[model samples]
Each structure stands twice: as structure tokens, then as C-alpha cells.
Target: MEGILNAVVLFSNFVLIPGMAYGSQLALGALGVTLIYSILRFANFAHGDLMAFGTMFVILITWWLQSIGVGIDPLPTALLALPFGMAAAIAISLLSDRFVYRFYRRNKSPAVIFVIVSIGVMFLMNGLVRVIIGPNDQEFGDGARFLIKVREFKEATGLNEGLALKLSQGLTIAVTFVVVIALFWFLQKSRTGKAMRAYSDNEDLALLSGVNPDKVVIVAWVIAGSLATIAGTLYGLDKSFKPFTYFQLLLPIFAAAIVGGIGHPVGAVVGGYVVAFSEVTVTYAYKKFLIYLVPESWEPESLVQLLSTEYKFAVSFVILVVVLLVRPTGIFKGKVL
Candidate 1:
């Protein structure tokens, strides 16, 4: 029984908790991607860089605040700087839409053209972020490091295994809950949200029915920008902020979005947890976990990991390929990609 308890605790510490935090981050990112695809009718390849850009601003603001001796004890100082970072991100998103996307939208360019343009934008944003913050990892997290300490847990439970929960993980889950609720409310009840939905469903019909295309597009960008910033900031708090890391995150983010159903918001959230857990579970070395459950004679001699941690991203790629091949519309029947 004690071994079983220890096994559960160990699994929770290494896999469950981290998976949830990572899922929340991925969900937010996937939401942004789905929003743009639903409304704008194109996948924004630059979404990852958008996240990096917003996080870069948040990091700068956090540093400035720390230098001035301002902070919210027990809470990340990044929270205080979030609004400013969001605003900056939103501004850039709008500017990009106006200068780059709007022209193509006006000309009624094909989705392929928009996709190519987004790739260009991706490179541009990536370059800009690297120039501003450098390609090196940036450590900006500051606050209470843990909500539950391993030593404390062991002492309290008198168990061989301990569970530790980080403050950033808790914050990520909490903030994601709030954001998702607010988004659902807005989409379900607000006039603007309805218009956006109508446009997404049928642009020609929506325009004929007096839905302003420009307004819908603007709102989509605003929401996407906000989500990107929040997700990036939360992820940075949980891990370190590296510009290239976010770029690499593009694979998992897109996988989550597609797996959940590209145009479906609910699907994005669900897909996030699915991808996160899959990656964490598959990469985790399960030798100790099995040892806790099996007889001494059956104890494994080698790590029971399906794949190394370094190949975790490949899990997302495989899932993405499988989903695309089996059901292009995804689990929620969002849109045929």
C-alpha cells in the first residue's frame, strides 16, 4: 500500500502536474490558432513568434519593475506587467493585420497566399524577437516558487515519495480557467462574438446580413493577441523564456489545435491536454513506477520509457500526422484541414 501510494505521488509529481500546466499553455496557444483559422481562414505560421514577442515585452517590463523595487509578494511580478505586455502584443497584431494581412484580404487572396505570407511574417517576427532579446534563454520568473514543497509533503504524509507543485503551474491552471470562461461567455452572449461566429460560419452570408468584416477580423486579432501573450507569459514563468523554444513550440501548438479540431475552441482546449499528457507519459521513464507495482523478481532492468525526453516533440508530430490521415476534421469535427 505504501509503495502504491509512493507510485501515485511520483507519477503526479513528474507527469500529471507538469502535463496540466503544459496543457493549459498549449490550450491557450491552440485557441489563438483556431480563432484565426476559423475567422481569418488561414493558419498563421507566425503565431509562435507572436507568443515570443509578447513574452519578450513581459520580460522587459518585469525587469523594469524589479529594478524599481516593485513586486507582488507570493505572486509573480510578471502578472503586474501582463497588461502592458498584452497591450503591446495587441498593438503589434493589429499593425500586422493592417499592413500585411489586410492588403491580401482586400485583394481576396487565396488561403495558400495567406499561409505563405504568414510564413514570411513568422521569419520577420522571429528575427525581431531575436534582435531585441537575443536567442539565449531568459529567466524572468519571480515569486513563490512552489505551492507544495516535496520535503513538506514527505514530512506531512510520512511517505517515501513526495509531490511538489509549482506556483507557476497553479497560476497557469487558474488563469486558463478564467480566460476560457470569459471567452466562452463573450462568444455565447456578446453581439460582436455572434457576428464573428456568423462570419466564420459563412463570410458571404455574414457580410450580406450586415456583419462588418473588418470588425470581425479586428476582434479576432485582438483575442488571438491576448491569448498568445498570456500563454507565452505563463509558459515563461513555468520554464525559461527562450525565443527559439517558442518557435519549436509551434509544432505542439499546431498539433493541439488540429487534434482538437482546428476551428473549434473547445477542441483546442481538449486537444492541448491530450497532446501534453501523451508527450509526458510517453517520454517518462517508468522503471520506478513499475517497481512500485510489481514483484521484486519482476523489477525491470532498464528504463521503461517509450521514447527519450528529447524526442517528445516527435510525439506531437506523429499524432498530428495520424489525425490528419485518419480524420482531417479532427475529434470535434471542426474543419477539414
Candidate 2:
């Protein structure tokens, strides 16, 4: 029983907690992508870079605050800078839409054209972020690092394995829950939300019904920008911020969005956890876990990992490919890709 408890604690520390936090981040990101696709009818390849861009602002503001000795104890100062970051991201998003996407939208260009243009925008934002923040890891996390310390847990539980919960992880989960609830409420209940939904359902009919397309588009960008900033900031606080790392995050974010059902908000959130847990479970070394569960003589000599951590992203790719082949519409029956 003691060994069993230890194994569970170890698993939670290494896999469950991290997976939940990562899933929350991915869920937020995929939500942004799904929003753009659902209303704007195009895959914003620049979404990841937009996250990086917003995070860049957050980092800069955090540094400035720290320099002035301003902080909120037991919580990261980045939280205070978050609104500014969201504003910057929203401004950029609206500007891009006006200058780049609006032209295509007005001309009634094909969706493919919008996609290609997004890729171009992706490169430009990626470069701009790199130039501003440089290609290095930035650690802006401060204040309370752990909500539950490993030593304290071990002392209390008398277990060989200890569980440590990070403040960032807890914050990520909490913030995601609130954001998701608010988003769903707005989408289901608000007048603008209904208008947006109607427009998405049938643009021509909605236009005839006096639904303002411009207002819907602006609202969509604002929501997307806010999601991007929050997701990026939470992720940076949990792990570390590196421009290229966010770039690499694109694959997993897209995979989560598609796996849940592109253009489906609920699907995106569920797919995020699915992808996160799959990656963590596959890459985790389970030698100690098996040792605790199996008889001494039956214990394995080698690590029981299905794949190395370095190949974790491949898990997302595989899942994406499988989902695309088996159910292009995804788990929630989103639009066919």
C-alpha cells in the first residue's frame, strides 16, 4: 500500500500536474485558433507568433516593473502587465486585419489566399519578436514558485515520492477555467455573441438580417488576442519563454485545434488535454513506477518509456495525422479540413 501510494504521488508529480498545466495552455491557444477559423474562415498560421509577440510585451513590462521595485508578492508581476500585453497584441491583430486580411476579405479572395498570407504574417511577426526579445530564453517568473513544496509534502505524507504543485500550474488551470466559462457564457448569451454566431452560420443571411460583419470581425480579433496573451504568459511562467520554443508550439496548438474539431471551441479545449496527456504519458520514464507496482524480481531493468521526451512533439504530429485521416471533422464534428 505504501509503495502504491508512492507510485501514485510520483506519477502525479511528473505527469498529471504538468500535463494539466500544459493542456490548459494549449487549450487557450487552440481556442484562439478556433475562434479565428470559425468566424474569419481562415487558419491564422501567425497565431503562435502572436503569442510570442504578446509575451514579449509582458516580459518587457515585467522587467520595467521589477526595475522600479514594483511587485505583487506571492504572484508574478507579469500578471499585472498582462492587460498591456493583451492591448498590444489586440492592436497588432486589428492592424493586420485592416491592412492584410481586410483587403482579401473585401475582394472575396479564396481561403487559400488568406492562409498563405497568414504564413507570410507569421514569418514577419516571428522575425519581429526575435529582433525585439532576441533568440534566448527569458525567465520572468517570480514571487511564489510552488503552491505545494515537495519537502513539505513528503514530511506530511510520509511517502517516498513527493508531490509538488507549482503556482504557475495552479494559476494556469484556474485562469483557463474562468476564461472558458466566460467565453461560453458570452457566446451563448450575449447579443453580440449571437450576432457573431449567426454570421458564422450563414454570412449572406446574417448580412441581410443586419448583422454587422465588421463588428463581428473586430470582436473576434479582440478575443483571439486576449487568449493568445494569456496562454503565452501562463506558459512562460510555467516553463521559460524562448521565441523559437513558441514557434515550435505551433504544431501542437494546431494539432489540438484539429483533434478537437477545428472551429469548435469545446473541441479545442478537450483536444488540448488529450494531446497533452498523450505526450506526457508516452515520454515519461516509468521504471520507478513499475518497480513500485511489480514484484522485485519482475521489475524491469530499463526505462519503460514509449518514447523520449525529445520526440514528444512527434506524438502530436502522429495524432494529427491519424485524426485527419480517420475523422477530418474531428471529435466534435467541426468543419471538415
Candidate 3:
């Protein structure tokens, strides 16, 4: 029983909880990518930078709220400032559509053209975020730090292993659940969402059936912007926000989207968990976890990790390459591109 308990605790601490939280973040980010690919029909390479931009706004607002003596007790004030960040992100997305994307869209440019333009947009947003946030890590989460303290868990369970649940982890999972449910509801039931789906299915058919292409594009961008802000803010709260870190996140985010099925929302969510768990499980030093489970004489000397933490991000890329080579349609039958 003691061995079993220790094993459970080990898995929870190193794999289960962290994977779920990180999966939630990736799910949200991948959902945004999938939405753009579904509706706009191009990979929005600018998405990670958009997340950084939105998170930058949230950090600023959170700081302002803290300065003014306004806060949510036991919860991060960043949560309250989230809506403002989302709004700013939406405005920027709309403006970009009007000024930048709109021109290419009007010319009926090829998908590659849009992808290239998104790369340019990505650079612009990256530069803008760096200028505003100064390329430094910013910690904005302010409130109760842990929902469950390690000592409290150890005492309650009378166990050698203690489980610590951070507030940010709980918040990330909860928010992701709420957002995902709402998104699925919108996509599966709402009229405008149906129009978006119809547009995605066949552009000419959707237009002939009176689905307004412009309205669909606007709705998709709005959803993408809102999702990017929430995902970015939650990530920053859970970890620390750095402009470059979000840029790095693009690899995993895109990998999740591609692995799950580029244009499929459900695939995006599943792919997020897949990528997250793979990264954690592959890189985690399992020597300690194994020691508690194995017989005393059988203990191993080495860390027994598959890869170093420095190569964690590469896990996603490797998975992505394998998935593309094996099943480009992803787990779902989404467009290969």
C-alpha cells in the first residue's frame, strides 16, 4: 500500500497534473490555430506573437490594477484584467485584417501568399511586443499562490510524498474547460458558427447559400484573438511571461494543431494533451519516481530520463514530423496542409 501510494504521488507530481495544465494551455493555443486554418484557410504563423502581444496587455493591466489597490483576494488580479487584454487583442486582429490581410484576401491570393504575409505579420508583432515589454520575463500573477500546499497534503495523507497544487494550475485547467465548452457550443449550434463551418466546407457553396464570407472571417478572427489572449495570460500566470518564450511556444502550438488535425477543433484539444504529456514524460528524470516503486536493491543510479530538459521543445517537433510522415490527415480527417 505504501509503495502504491508513493507511485501515485510520483505520477501526480511529475506527470499527471502538470500534463493536464500544460495540455490545457496548448489546447487553447491550438484551438486558435485551428480556427484560423479552418476559416481563413492559412496557417497563421503570427499566432504565437499575437499571444505575446495580448499577454503583454494583460500584464500591463494587471500591474495597473495592483497599483490602484484593486485585486481579487485568493485569485490573481490578472484574471480580472483578462477581458481588457482580450479586447485589445481583438481590436488589433480586426485592424490587421482590415489593413493587411484584407488586401491579400481581396486579391484572392494563394494560401502560400497568406502564409508569407503571416510570417511578416509575425515579425512585426514580435518586434512590437519586444518594444512594449522590453524582452524581459514579467511575473504578473498576484494572489493566493497555492490551492493546496505540500505540507498540508503530507499531513492530511500521513504520507512521505506531498502533493502541491498551485492556484495557477487549477485556474488554467478550469478556464480551459469553460472556454472549450463555450467554443464547442458556439461551433456546433450557433447560426454564425454554422455559417463558418459551411464556409470552411466549401467557400463557393457557402457564398451561394447566403453565408457572408466577410462575417465568417470577422468571427473567426475575433474568436482567435480572444483565445490567444486567454491562453497567453494563463500561461504567463502559470509560468512567467517572456516575449521570446511565447515565440518558442509556436513550435509546440503548431505541432499540436498539425498533429491533431489542422482544421479540427476537437483534434487540436487532443493533440495538445498528446504533445504536453510526451514532452513531460520524455524529459522528466524518473530516477526518483522509480526509486519509490522498485525494490531497494534494484534502484538505478542514472536519472533514466529519455532527454534533457533543454531539448523539451524538440519533442513536439519530433512528434510533428512523425505524424506528418505517417498520417498527415491527423487523428481527424482534417486537411493535410
Candidate 4:
């Protein structure tokens, strides 16, 4: 009974809640990538920067709002400013597509060329964000900090182990769920969204059927902008917002997009959770918790963390490698393009 109880607690603490929250974040981020990939037809390396920029906008707005004593009661007022952040991102994306990408599209440039172009766009966006934000960590998310505390959990459950769930995490999950559902509904049911999917499925057929590639691409960018803002802001709320953090996130975002199957919206969500769970599980130290379950004599003479937090990035790459070796198309038949 003791062993069973310990195992159940360990599983819950190390896997269940953390995985869901982290997965939600990944899914949100991956959705933006998948949308851009489907319409833009390239692996956008700069998406991470877009995420950074969006969160920065939210952080700035939050700080400004807080300074004026205007805060959302019960919930973080940053939620109120998220739309503005999203709008800023959308406007920027539209401008970028027009000035930086429209010519290439008109000239019928190769996908590889577009990929290289994205690198340039990424550099430009990165520089622009750093310049505007001054390359410093910004903290703006505030209000209703924690839904539950570890002490409360212990008192409520009468368990040796307890976990705290931040209000930010809860809000992040709820908002992400709503956004993802809305996105899927748009893609699967809305007329324009279906048209976009048709284009993604077969560009020639879509064009033959009178699909306006430009319009569809613009819509994709709009949706991607919204997603990026939400992902970046929520992540900043849950973790911390650092301009450079987005640069590091690009590889994992790529891994998530590929893992879930590129160009597939559903795949992106799955891949996000996969990446999140892998990172959390591998890096989370289990030694302290395990000692409670195992007898002293049986406890191994070493820490049980699969990998240290410093190697968290490696976890994503390793998963990607295995996925490619076993199933290049991803577990869900993501985009071959």
C-alpha cells in the first residue's frame, strides 16, 4: 500500500499536471508554426523572435497598465492587453509579407530561397525587438498568482508530497484550449479556413478552383500572429520573459513542429505536449521524491534525474532524431513539404 501510494504520488507530481501545462504551451506555439508552414511553405526560423516580440509587447503593456493602477481584478490585467499585442504582431507580419516576401512570391522563388529569406526576416525581427525592448528581461504578468499552494495541497490531501498550481498556468491552459479550438473550428468548418486547407492540400487545385493564394496566406499570417502573441505572453506569465530566450526556443519549436507532423495543425498540438513532457520528465530531479518510495537499503546511490536541466535542449533534439529515424513523416503523417 505504501509503495503504491508513493508511485501514484510520484507519477502525478512528475508527469500529469506539469505535462499538461507544458504541452499546452508547446501546442500553442506549434500551432503558429504549422499555420505559417502550411501557407508560407517554409520552416520559419524567425517564429521564435515573433513569439519574443509578442510577449515583449504584452510585458510592456502590462507594466504601463500596472503603473497607472489599472489592473484586471482577480485575473492578470495582461489578459486585457493581449489583444493589442496580437494586433501589433499581425500588423508587423502583414508588413513583413508585403515588403520582404511578396516580391519573392511574385517571382516564383524556390522554397529553399524562401527558407533563406526567412533567416533574413528572422534576423531583422530579432534586431528590431532587441532595439525596441532594449534587450532586457521584462515582468508584467500579475494578479491571482497561485490557485493552490503546496502547503494547501498537503493539508487537503494529507500527503507527504504536494504541488502548487499557479493561476498563470491555469489561465494559460484555459486560454490555449479556447484558442486552439477556435483555430481548429476555423480550419475545419469556416469557409475561408477550408479554402486555406484546400490550398495547403493542393496548391494547383486550389488555384484552379479560384482560391486566392495571397488572401489565404494573409489569413494564415493573421492567425499565426494571434497564436504567437498568446504563446509568448502566456509563456512569459508562466516562466519569465527574456528577449534571448526566444532565440533558444527556435530549435525546440522546430522539433515540436516536425515531431507533430509539419503542416498538420493537430500534429503540432501533439508534438508540443510531447516536447514539453519530454523536457519536464528528463530534467526534473526524482531523487528526493524517490527516496520516499524506496527503502533506504534499496535506494540507489545516485540521483535519478534522467538528465540535468542544462541538457533540456538535448531532449528535444534527441526526440527529433528518433522520430526521423523511425518515422520521417512524424507519428501523424505531418507535411512532407
What does candidate 1's lDDT look like per residue over 247-325, in tens digits?
Answer: 9989999999999999999999999999999999999999999999999999999999999999999999999999999
Candidate 2, residue 60: how far the Cα is off, in Å = 0.4
Q: Can you tell me which runs of candidate 3 are displaced by over 4 Å?
A: none
User: What tens digits encode model 2's per-residue C-alpha lDDT throughout 91-156?
Assistant: 999999999999999999999999999999999899999899899999899999899999999999
Per-prediction TM-score: 0.99, 0.99, 0.99, 0.96
Question: Over the full model, what C-alpha lDDT does candidate 3 score relative to the true structure?
Answer: 0.93
Model 4 deviation from native, Cα RMSD in Å = 1.5
Q: Which digits, one per residue and each the tens of the lDDT, describe model 4 over residues 1-337?
A: 6555766776776677777777787788888988888888888877888888777787778888888999877899889889889998888889999998899988998889998998898898899888988787777767888888878987887877776788888888898889889989999999999999999999999999999998998998999888988988888888888878877888777888889899999999989988988998888877776777778888766788899899999999999888888887886898765
User: What's the distance in Å from true for residue 89, model 1?
Assistant: 0.9
Predicted candidate 3 versus true structure: per-residue lDDT over 141-166, tens digit per residue: 88999998889998999988888889
The Cα RMSD in angstroms, rounded to one decimal, for candidate 2 relative to the true structure is 0.7
* Reference-based lDDT, each prediction: 0.95, 0.95, 0.93, 0.85
By lDDT, the better pick of 2 and 3 is 2
In terms of lDDT, model 2 sits at 0.95
**What is the C-alpha local distance difference test score of candidate 4?**
0.85
